[model samples]
Target: MSLIHVNDDNFASMVQKGGVTMAEFGAPWCPPCKVLLPILEELSAELGDSVPILTVDVDESPVSAGRFGVMAMPTVIVFHDGEPVEKLVGLRSKAAYAAVLAKAAALSPESPAAAR
Candidate 1:
C-alpha cells in the first residue's frame, strides 16, 4: 500500500480506524521530511495491508500536527488501537521504523499473531 495523505479533517478518522498506524507529521519544504518520505513509502509497500502508513503535511494540517504535539519536522508517531504508542522525532533508519511497526503490530489485538 502507498502512503495515505491525511489532512486535519480526516486525520483522526484515518488513524483511529484500528491496528497499527504510522503517521508522519512533516512539511514539504523540510529536508529531513523529504528524506524520510521514500523510506516510509518503502515500508508501506513492504508491510502491505498489515500496517497503514500515513503522511500529514504540517503546513497544511496544522491542527493534526499540533494535536500530536509534533514540534519537529519528520515526527513519526506509531499508533496502536487508535492510541499513540511510539513517537520518533527527526529522520531515522528504515530498520528503526520497521522495528517499531513490528512491535506495534505484535501488540495489536487485531493482528493475527496477537490473536494466536
Candidate 2:
C-alpha cells in the first residue's frame, strides 16, 4: 500500500486503528526527509498491503511529532497495536528499515492488518 499522510487532525484517529504501522515524522524542507521518501515508497511497494506506512510532516503536525518526541528531521517510529515499539532517528538503509518493519510485524502477529 502507498504511504498515508497524517496531520494533526487525523493522526490520532489513524494510528489508533492499531496493527503494525510505520510512521515517519519529518518535514518537506528537511533534506534527509526528501531522501527518505523514495526509500519509504520502495518499502511500501515491497510490503504491499501487509504493512501500512504513515508520513507525518512535523511542520504541519507538531502535536504528533511532539508527542513522539521527534527532535530530528527524519524520525521513523515503528508502532504495533497503536503504540510505539521502536524509534529510529536519521537516514537509514532499506535493509535497516526492513529489519525494523519485520520486527514490528513479529511483535504483532495477530494484528488484523498485518499481512502475515
RMSD (Å) of each candidate, 1 decimal: 2.1, 1.9
The lDDT leader among the candidates is 1
lDDT of 2 by residue, 1-116 (tens): 78999999998778745577889999889999999999999999987877788999999999899998999979999888788899999999988998888888877677543453
For each candidate, what TM-score against the reference? 0.92, 0.91
Return the top candidate by TM-score. Answer: 1
- Candidate 2 clashing pairs, residues 3+ apart or interchain: 1-48
lDDT of 1 by residue, 1-116 (tens): 99999999999999855688999999889999999999999988877777889999999999999999999988999999899999999999999998888888888666842432
Clashes of 2: 1
The TM-score, computed over Cα atoms with residue i paired to residue i, of candidate 2 is 0.91
What value does the lDDT take at residue 75 in candidate 2? 98
Weakest ten-residue segment in model 1 by summed lDDT: 107-116
